[model samples]
Target chain A: MQLTQFLSRRRAQKAESRSPLFSFLYSRKIAPYLFVSPFILSVLVLYLYPFYSAIQMSFQRVLPGQVFYVGLENYERVMNPIFFRALQNTSIYVVLTVILLTVLPLMLALILNHRLTRWSNFFRAAIFIPALTSVVVAGTIFRLIFGESDQALANQVLSFIGFSPLDWRYEAWTAMFLMVAMATWRWLGVNVIYFLAALQTVNNDLTEAASMDGANALQRFRHVTLPAIKPIIVFLVTITIINGFRMFEESYVLWESSSPGYIGLTVVRYIYREGIQNNALGFGAAVGIILLAIIFVVSMIQLYLTGAFKKEH
Target chain B: MVHGRQDKLISAGLLAILIGFAFLSLFPVLSLLVASLSPASDLMRYGLAPELFFSSFDLENYRVIFGPEGSRYWTWYLNSIIVSSMLIALSLFFSSMVGYALAMYEFPGKRFIFIMVLLVLMIPFEIMMLPLFQLVITLGLIDTYFGTILPLIVAPVAVFFFRQYSLGLPKEVMEAARVDGCTEYGIFFRIMVPLMLPSFAAMAIFQGLISWNNFLWPLLVLRSNDMLTLPIGLATLLTPYGTNYQLLFAGAMLSIVPIVILFLVFQRYFIAGLMSGSVKG
Candidate 1:
């Protein structure tokens, strides 16, 4: 029926094409192209060209007005210890953040989603305020709070708890903890919003029936709510991992280009150091390609493991 | 009666937990605000302690920023505003057009174009940063506003969003406009644009926040000190030899004001826009 209607409409359009200027200007065949041309031109020039150039540059030694193909040299340079350290640090950051962001936000959303809860809107808004601040702002505050001085807030808390002050940036564990805490603080509310949206879609009738059938709150949540929001959880985890690998600003703001002993180095930071600051564009492009490969493989494995690709028969 | 009692207990417990987390979330901002208002000397001595709040409060740092000595700060602020405005305007215009066309038309290569968008979405920006920077240099657009905004103008995510949204728009309107002899461009501008107002509002805030807080791209492209955006400028104040706590804290706090105001006025759209990506993905 729709196809027949469309054909009739096409016939009418053809009949109305008596005016050459109107038909030429309003032809459906050409309008879409005109509409899409700007974006297509931009993507081809900015995105596709750069992407192609990045791959090509990765295999060459780029210099001022000159380029020479030195295949595998750039890739082999990426096999150094600092690069591996960055990879390890990024992986750790990704794992910790993905777990915390996924679990804690779901818990928060569940509480907020409770029917008897009061002032839920206020609580939601208050928590989400952190997400509005720039990472630079957040990093500045965290730096102050966790400063090396004994008078810093973190140290004050430490003294209150009977532990001595420790230099946060010097130690690997402390540095990792600070980065993870900052990320969680910044992103928790956004993830909670995601979960809350997904949770609202769950059928209240199903939960009511389960409760009437004598299922406890924990059991109902474990079975019904969890399964219902699995896709969102997978999606958030994938996004968090991607953001995690792309993390440069957080570490950059905290320690700038140089992290103490490279404890807080991230993959993107490594790329920036090699590409922009050091002027080894080829080396940086190589590291970026490797980082891309890591993200792709990890995301695919995660999707497969979570059964995101499996048909729901 | 028993169930009611149990429900009340659970509700109270949950509310208490929610309050604690909310406080945790707001603590950093509160501390920063207080520290921003405090004297720099007190902050330097006590290192952003709660005690400094009681000892003194001063607007000296803010005055410095607004005064002649801090002209560089305002320059960076203005640069950020200009870049963000151009980015939001151009990105919204171009991406929405592409997205609307993809949704409303059944032309050849539509599928291929959409697949290209998806491919772009999967690739992170860092992967292309070096080459893009090189391209900017090659084009002699370095340190220019166009260079900073060019690569991001056709954001893939925004295109995907507008496409998804346009799918839900009624097609009958387009047919009526066509029958009335309205040009296709006229239909989009006169008929469809007003319909997509909510989308425009949502994306405006979303892209505005991104471009305003954006650091890395601007850091690479904008080389002159006077051309620095807020983030990069504020970041440069913190050096190993000596740091400017007053300017750094105050600048950082001030940088968040525009976005915070935007959030307050359009809270619903902000949350909806954020959730839109996750919901569809």
Candidate 2:
């Protein structure tokens, strides 16, 4: 039935070649738009409308039927101490995770790139297996591992090493570190894959030339391999920063909106805490807008630094 | 390329470091697997710690997870499969169509559409969820499966990837098909679709992994027990009062199976797809 309809449609287009209306409607210029209607509808409904609603929500009081315009009140209230604390916590988390994600994965990728890493595929699979697991699952396991009790895996390991067991998430630093550690563990392999892909493009000839010029391995890599893969490094940095800002699941799963001193509260976590959990939809919308603005600025800066906007004259 | 004592030493050091990283990377998975295999008594005693004693190892946890009592677990698993499959299919279709039109055609507002896609890709989905939920509530799709799946069907990342892949497709072939009296839809469906199979495979894996592992939206939209996806369902097991850690760990372990199988089966395409989406325009 569909095939016959399609054929008849095609026949109509061909048969009505001289009709101006049919010709215009069947034109290639218009057909692409018709083909793209689904996406257009999706964007309009899903992306555009929701985005407009978020902006609208940010400016209103957000009470049902009593909704009234509140000019800059949400933004003013968003500058409270708690918001600043959340901001500080998020900044610290992003910086720490970005550094770890950058250096460790680069080092691992460098090591994995070495021909001596036998069964590299197996090693890669083993390393990347965690990436397949959901963050909630990993966070659950990590919570158990880093549990406050003596039976926790982390404390058990500590005891094995002749150290006394301690509550891992009691201290703010340790709790924050636990979340970071989980993020690092889950994403290490993914970053390694990124760097490995970049490493494949690094020409050995340049490194060999550097080595022949009396450079050591480190110097050779510094001058040759790093420059060759600069774009990918920049790309990974962008990805890491974006992901760092969006850190929610690690905290949500571990502490579930009950972290001590707001140590584990990321921007998105705060959004969830206020919007869904606290029933402060308007406040969450304001925070969400702020988060979006911060991400946008940071992304633009990263892109600018990487010369992503530069074009050949 | 020359083998020497210094090279051998460096190679050995590299191998050791890589192995160490790999071990650290696999620690959580290894621990999860070990905990899943241990009997519930031992698991509760040890608290997901890696127990070296083989005497405590058993299939009891798996039995409890897949047993007759674990019908809820099966529902969550089945719900995840259904939602993910629908998302993968619809995402592949609409995203590829948008990508194909953007890459291969000249139309009004093309640049604007492409820019929208790029911007959408950059904006985190978290920010939009609040209002999107409002939209969902207004549309009265709050707990419906279609509500959970609709907003996710046209993923910007998948569309971006398909656009990049389709940009590389030879336009001459499409033009030739057009000249051969094939309708545009027919040409795309029969001709361009086959040519873009690699992109389809790659997007399938990418979208499948994402949809299967998606937690936040599904958690917000899916309110009922049977409606919950795997991540949300498994997470609900960790409530403060008498949390069922045994079933949570076991279910969590089981949740890794489909995506792991997908990654293993399409491991080549997965990496290739990601690289293509990342390394180039």
* Model 2: per-residue Cα lDDT over A266-299, one tens digit each: 7888888889888788889999999989988988
Residue A117 of candidate 1: its Cα lDDT? 91
Cα lDDT for residue B240, model 2?
Answer: 49
Model 2 regions lying over 4 Å from their true place:
A1-25, A304-313, B1-3, B41-46, B50-53
TM-score of chain A taken by itself, candidate 2: 0.88
TM-score per candidate, chains pooled? 0.95, 0.93
Q: Where does candidate 1 stray beyond 4 Å?
A: A1-25, B41-46
Give me the iRMSD of candidate 2, please. 2.6
Query: Which residue pairs in model 1 clash with each other?
Result: none
RMSD of 1: 4.1
